[model samples]
Target chain A: ELKVEQNPLFLSMQEGKNYTIYCNYSTTSDRLYWYRQDPGKSLESLFVLLSNGAVKQEGRLMASLDTKARLSTLHITAAVHDLSATYFCAVVNNNDMRFGAGTRLTVKP
Target chain B: EAGVAQSPRYKIIEKRQSVAFWCNPISGHATLYWYQQILGQGPKLLIQFQNNGVVDDSQLPKDRFSAERLKGVDSTLKIQPAKLEDSAVYLCASSLDWGLTVGELFFGEGSRLTVL
Candidate 1:
């Protein structure tokens, strides 16, 4: 079974600051995914890290994976109020995908 | 191209009542998944289907929850005699390939269920 864990289940950051959310998996996984969910909305795909050292960025968000460490990071660069949302990281081992507890982010001005 | 579509955006019912949610995946997608997301938690996969066939249903509560995707394009999930613990958002997602594929899974807006 693949168990996914994320650090700092709740985050509160000021606008224009930066932070990173970490995701660690218990087993070896081939794929890592990042998603964002707004209040009362469905989840939206952010990034897909398929290999070690893979980094993807979109707007103020960047995600990277380290397969050897079984870790992935979603970094927020100079965050803004629009970036406030719950972030979830999921890992796929074999054919099963397991998600973390999610990190809820609140950006205050 | 239309994304995943779901119906009954919100439902409020008392304990022991029944509720059903529906989902229609994107065209040509072969994989469909149903997930339950409780407040302040991540989405939990309840069932996954690969073109009308059950691929994984280990986490589903068969005692009270049931789901079906007969034609491989749309699906329905039903909960009978619901409990307070069952109050959550039911999300539907679809992918173009199987679970092992490395791609984004399009998701629906989800149906929120409130059990009193």
Candidate 2:
């Protein structure tokens, strides 16, 4: 069974601070994805890292994948209040996809 | 383009009752997925369909849960004799074939279920 683990399940960071959420998987995967979900809302795609060393960034969020290590990361730079949400990293293996437990981020002023 | 659409944004029922949720995927999407997400947890895949055909349903609990996609367009998920643990958000997502992309999925707002 493929499993994904995320560190710092709950994070409270001050605005303008930088933090990184780690996602570790147990098996080989061709790609990984980062998604954000707000209270009572569906997931919003953040990034798709398809290859090792692949990094993608948008606004204050940057995601990178290391396929060999079976790890992925979502880094938040200079976080803002609106960045508060639950972030999840998922790895796709064959036709099945496994997701991490998710990290809930709260940006406080 | 419009994203995935789901009905009955919220539903409350007593335990052991039956409930159903509907989903309409994006236009021309070939793949549809149903996910169950408990509070403070990531979405777990329950079943997947490929153009009206069952593709994967290994994770689904066959005894009380059932789902089907008809005409390769719309899908419905049903749960009977629901348990308190089944009180969670039922999300529906759709995407193109896996070969087209790295399995990027578009999700609906999800139907929140509360069992009393």
For each candidate in turn, the TM-score is: 0.97, 0.97
Question: For each prediction, how big is the interface RMSD?
Answer: 1.0, 1.6
- Give the alpha carbon lDDT tens digit for every residue of B5-99 in model 2: 99899999999999999999999889999999999889999999989998899999999999999799999999998999999999999998743
Candidate 1, residues B25-58, lDDT tens digits: the string is 9999999999999998889999999999999999
**Residue B85 alpha-carbon offset, candidate 2, angstroms:** 1.2
- Per-prediction count of colliding residue pairs? 0, 0
- In candidate 2 the C-alpha lDDT for residue B64 amounts to 99
User: Candidate 1 lDDT, tens digit per residue, A24-61?
Assistant: 99999879999999999999999988999999999999
